[model samples]
Target: DERLGLVQMAIDEHTWLASEAREGETVELLVKSHPHLSIVHFTLNGADDVLRYRKWCWSGPMFRMITMGRCGDTEAVVARACRDGADLDAGHFIMGPQMPDISSSAARSALAREDIAAAALLLHPEVLLWCREHKVWQASTEPLRRDERLKHTNRPSGTPQQPC
Candidate 1:
């Protein structure tokens, strides 16, 4: 009966979230509305419904959401996952390989497409460091370094280049 109860609860939550929740309400608020069920779903079942809803609502994966970066929804989802003790790094690792390689070209391509979020994420300092440390792509560092140098050079003598 307990197991059945959980299943029913999950179904109910899914239905409400899918059909009844307000347009701008975040997944975190919805999940937090039923903490025990959320914990069980996230911890025991990998929060499949949440992931599914992310895909359905955003039309992409978490990484894609991050790349899109239009809405703060992706960040909120990540924060909630971290608060709930989800393996954020694991999600990153799983999604990493599918991402465009951390290179200037990739960043430029994203920019050309007007995907500023994707470009920013690709050229992020941490991502640049990660690529260098992990040898994901040794060449990624050069363009970033060049860009930094250009930033400094372009600044007036008395003005410091703003950090990204």
Candidate 2:
């Protein structure tokens, strides 16, 4: 399976990144060679430009490249990547547990607690949808559920809030 092979290569590259420019070039080459390679999961150092490879998974190509060629636009890229290939149910791959639909409720919650910027780097669908739904850019706030809880608290209206 070329897609599975691509996933393995991404993982291997993350494990051993020698030169900065060279690593970037390597990743770029990967993208070019495998247009369907879309999923990339990884860690990173403080410097944004440096990515500490974790693990990656991808699908083939899609009707359009939702996130291709744009530096710093990982979510679109990943979603587009997932959309690229023929559908592969979770059971289809030998990779670890079914890849979470980054677009689901659970993933969204996890992303909220995570650094928004870092989550954005991963661009998992759950996080992206949450960000979009919340209109996160104008003002940063806790997730909608949290906000709702705060709005409907049963505490005395004028009482100073007690520690939980």
The per-model lDDT (C-alpha) reads 0.37, 0.35
Compose the digit string of candidate 2's lDDT tens values, residues 21-113: 222445567778988877442222111111122112322221111111223434433344255552334322112222323333333444556
Evaluated at residue 55, the lDDT of candidate 2 is 15
Maximum-TM-score candidate: 1
- Runs in model 2 with CA error above 4 Å? 1-103, 121-133, 136-142, 145-164
lDDT for model 1 comes to 0.37
Lowest summed lDDT window (length 10), candidate 2 = 46-55
State the displacement of the C-alpha of residue 72, model 1, in Å, after optimal TM-score superposition.
23
lDDT of 2 at 126: 47
What's the TM-score of each model vs. the native? Answer: 0.19, 0.17
TM-score (C-alpha) between model 2 and the true structure? 0.17
